[model samples]
Target: MESESSSESSLEKSMENVLHLQNSDNPGLILVIAPLNGTNYLPWSRAMKIALCAKDKIGFVTGEIKKPSKNSPMFKKWRRVDSTFWESNGPLLYNIKREISLFTQGNMPLMVYFTKLKKLWDEVQCLRPFLVCTCGNCTCGASKAIADFDEDEKLIQFLMGLGDHYDHVRNQMLLIDPLPSASKAYSMALRVEKKKDV
Candidate 1:
């Protein structure tokens, strides 16, 4: 992934400059946190393309690698170990990139101003976050994958328990795809919540 966050990609619909995510002109909407990895579980990745079909705005933070050859052997080994979660939800491992930033160039901001960069996950949490979804390789390894169909559905039900619905509607789903790196297709729903901060 990229060391620093880059410009907002037209590849996805995002509104990184807008603050105050509640009481807008609309009813129910979502703020997605995509991992952009090519896995079947991470909703953040392009695997679940259908979920984005409905009307909504999405924000993006894309990482890139100019030279894959430069990474340590340990990184490659770690990825290989993680891909075992295809059949079910396992403990997720994080390969947190060095850092990422907002996708807009709205106006002039000095290093200090930019450092005031408060729009990361802390800000996301402040929004009362209706949905928090992630999909990627299994946490333990392929030997411990969740391969049963019913068990998979149970995982979805578990995720739904994470929050409440924002729309007068229930079971809100999204699928956005034709992503550049998706290895398989996936679908997920993240309930919407309004801003919870003062």
Candidate 2:
């Protein structure tokens, strides 16, 4: 009987620990100092792990803790933390793609418009990174081909998002034998904007 009561006490304590949220814990809490800017993924991920571990919430990210049923007492807090940290690929990916599809330069300056679109593009790349060739002896050049295709797609998207005033410039860019890269395209557009300003 004593052992049974002790076991129950231990279980209750564990549940309490899992459900507890400190004053600092909230949905809007920023987990890492530096955001994952594609290039610094290693250090950024390490920092995130340390932060989540400190909060005793690493299990949620690591998949060690399964999501609780809606009626479960832990469900609400679990959801809040999960949404804050976890970048689930489905809905988030769809939303980012939709934003990119709809993005356009209206009244914003060329630099401002390009910066915003660049951010969205970076997020898309981060979320769906290009797959590296793993086999050591392969020589098909498929990886490079895929990368070139990706760049071309981005170039097209960038051209498509420009204002109607850039129709002539956009048409000229599309006519090039080898289309310019997205950065080059941006520079071309900036020149046009500057000429107009003058």
Q: Which one wins on TM-score?
A: 2
| lDDT of model number 1 | 0.27
For candidate 1, report its TM-score: 0.16
Kindly list the per-residue Cα lDDT of model 1 for residues 123-170, writing each as its tens digit.
322222233223454455442333333234333333332233322222
**Candidate 2 — what's its lDDT?**
0.79
In candidate 1, position 131 carries an lDDT of 31
Q: Which stretches of candidate 1 lie over 4 Å from their true place?
A: 1-14, 17-24, 28-54, 58-136, 139-145, 149-198
lDDT of 2 by residue, 17-121 (tens): 865777887666788878765446568778988988888888876667778789977778667766766665666568778888898888877798889888788
Q: By TM-score, how accurate is candidate 2?
A: 0.59
Once superposed on the true structure, which residue ranges of model 2 sit more than 4 Å away at CA? Answer: 1-47, 52-87, 135-138
